[model samples]
Target: MQGIELTLQDEAATIELGEDLALALKAGDCLALSGDLGAGKSTLARAFLRAMADDEALEVPSPTFTLVQTYDLRIPVSHFDLYRLADVSELDELGFDEALSDGICLVEWPENALAALPKSRLTATFSHLGDGRTVTIAGEAAALSRIERSLAIRAFLRERGYGHAKRRHLSGDASARAYERILVAGEPVRILMDSARHTPGPILQDGKYYQQLAHLAEDVIPFVAIDSDIRTKGFCAPEIYESDLDAGILLIEDLGSDGILDADGRPIAERYLESVRVLAHLHAQPVTRDISLGTITHHIPDFDRRAMKIETSLLLDWYLPWKRGEKASDTERTGYFAVWDQLIDLMASSEKKLLLRDFHSPNIIWRGERSGFERIGIIDFQDSMIGPTAYDVASITQDARVTIEPDLRDIMLSLYCAERNALGAFDETLFRRDWHLMSAQRNCKLVGIWVRLMQRDGKPFYMKHMPRTFSYLEVALQHEALAPLRDWCIKAGIL
Candidate 1:
């Protein structure tokens, strides 16, 4: 969602805002705060705690030394201070997980737990602005939706001059009408706007509109949220003016029709290297407590044992039938299932890292310049996860629709590996081994996914990419680590 830039008149306004937030919070919620030492971090915390329960003796001390402190309230509350932490691992001793299970957590100096925190939590950053302060709040789907409701209520209050509206228009009809007029007529409307439109596709699954909207916003809105900063630093995306996460809409600057994939059907050597470099920079940015993997995991359903089994079944139900034009024999099917199981186990054991699950050609828009390398603009990155690094590398090199030149692919991989080495400890040999293994694993799962998209979802456009996807699988199977899968595919006559 787009961040609202506000200028508070005084600490009273800040405390009032915090009290309003406290009244709105529920159990299992998280609010991460970041700002300089005296920017009212503890002041806001005190205000929130006081509002939760009338415990005047509640010693809401600065958690600078303890790292975290918990207070028993009507709803459990945990206050954390990472100002003294040396690294994220230091949080392990504080029983943070237990707190997350049944409390509303308010964290101060959250940067210390950046890597280990959840991806879908709320974040509030406070900064001094002259004699007052500026606070920016952001969160995942549920949290953002909650905040949106609160904002709507606040807007209603302001509209009636702090008096009540005779009848609240909470059905969001006014909002929808406002958006339509602004979008279709280009008439200036007070709400956020965007250029993207809904085209023919699968009716989004039942009970998933908000989830999907959140996903879309996560992917698209952030470009506008940070567009100016990114552009000044030499990156290209869209410029976002406003976003309402609760309404599932965004007002963003449109990057016109010349995407990199639209300009070049196949990735060239220079473009590939440049793309990899951009990814390296993105991953290398100092992990901020403001962003974390914790929130993403918390919002999306986890791949539990049952979900994994169901996903594996797709190979038999969709991919095999699509590829072979007939049902697989029991023996052949059993072997394929075994290979899938083994790959899933390997993936489960690997170390997790940030992965933009859909990194590929079509998502990279080409904003042309003499420097062909840096002209690429990235999109469709909201589904990024704290998964294997190789997942993203493989997503690009062995892309679904376009075939990356072999020489370019190798060069890009080498550049990525070297960059990783420079940043942290990495075993080059082991990294490459895992990279190949994960590549094979990703392609196998994707084969089933694409087949399901075509057969079950009636999206045949995805089927057009099967030949290129198969080529990636073929190369992956050649690696020694994936020999069992290679042999299994061959024996089943599906390689």
Candidate 2:
């Protein structure tokens, strides 16, 4: 592993460096703090610990007495003193093995356990340098490379006037996107979206990955284009601050954390009604197929039959087989397609409007201080397309991630329909018919998506929502229009 050496002039500089390291540190990482007693090993380690905990006054007492101190910070952390240890073998009794896998570790006098140290660890040796101290960091190649990338991000932030910003991880979502909040000294906190370039999968159809087939966004361009469109429409979408299109990085305004869901994790009817009104207003306007992106033209895609089928097919490919513990046969699969073809065709016949594919509680933020529809801060619409407006309404009212109680859902649907019908040109009858059909189609896709997320992607959290999704699907399946498909599901025992 290569080493990177830097000198910190004072205690503040030392703490700042530690905070920087804290950004890249994850669970299972080790910061072997090594140096003489007065060389500031504990100082650097304590600073790192405090930053991770987000509490400057956090007690980071030396582990000299206890030999190890564990803190339940955002990322659990362990501080160890090996000098007082009788034997390296005693580490097992101390649960060091489990601790390493559980959180970040900072070990002072790590040389005492040098023979037992994990090979994937980072070692920081501090030494006196004039009035300050020199900290040299060395680690496995992969770890060091990650450190370098963190350093690069720091530089990128500095150039954007966030040199002294306090970076906080906002974690990740189901997609490949990563987010961080950068709070500068006086400026409003900004969000840093780290969307890595998507690696295209094997060419299964017409040299495209599943994302391409589904018309899903592959990078940050769609977000930028969509954000501009939403802002131009006088909505509450976050403003883009600075962007690096090639690097897939965007520094944008931070939408406050006040979500529409209440303490019970259910949507507040008032806020959800406001969102429905927002959709009603949007659908009533003239639709724009084109988005102005400087020299680039961003054309919103149509939610075509191929994309619809590709999504619905996930049920056959993942959920059904997983439920039965057996793969679907050609005949069964063909029958599944036959049922979906009718539903897809019905949805295709509906009038086209801008469909924010993921319109739901999770993507909607409640801005109570704002006016009317602007109070609903919409995010995560990069996969939006020109399709049946009913699709978005169904997604919100059915809400795969959060349960929309049937009664509450009825109120929401009624409010949405009332608002939509107020525009004398809209057809309430046709809209109602399309809503049930689209709801069933969307929920059908979510069933397979949740299953695939668990079985193939190793993310089981979404699986918890499958029952709620299926419940919504059942409600829609009961519609007279979906009777054929409902019968098919019953025959397959997937109902």
Q: Pick the candidate with the highest lDDT.
A: 2
Model 2 root-mean-square deviation: 2.4
Give stretches of model 1 more than 4 Å off: 1-239, 262-264, 285-313, 328-337, 347-351, 368-375
- TM-score against native, each model: 0.50, 0.92
Tell me the RMSD of model 1 versus the true structure: 21.8
lDDT (Cα, tens digit) per residue for candidate 2, span 307-425: 88888888888888889999888988888788878877777568788888999987888889878767988899999998888899998898888888889888988988888778757
Model 2 spans with C-alpha error above 4 angstroms: 1-13, 35-40, 125-146
The true-versus-predicted C-alpha distance at residue 318 of model 1, in Å, is 0.8
Cα lDDT over the full model 2: 0.84
| Number of the predicted model whose TM-score against the real structure is largest | 2
Residue 263, candidate 1: C-alpha displacement in angstroms: 4.2
Model 1 per-residue lDDT tens digits across residues 312-363: 4556667888778998788877776677677657666554554556677766
Q: Lowest lDDT 10-mer window, candidate 2?
A: 145-154
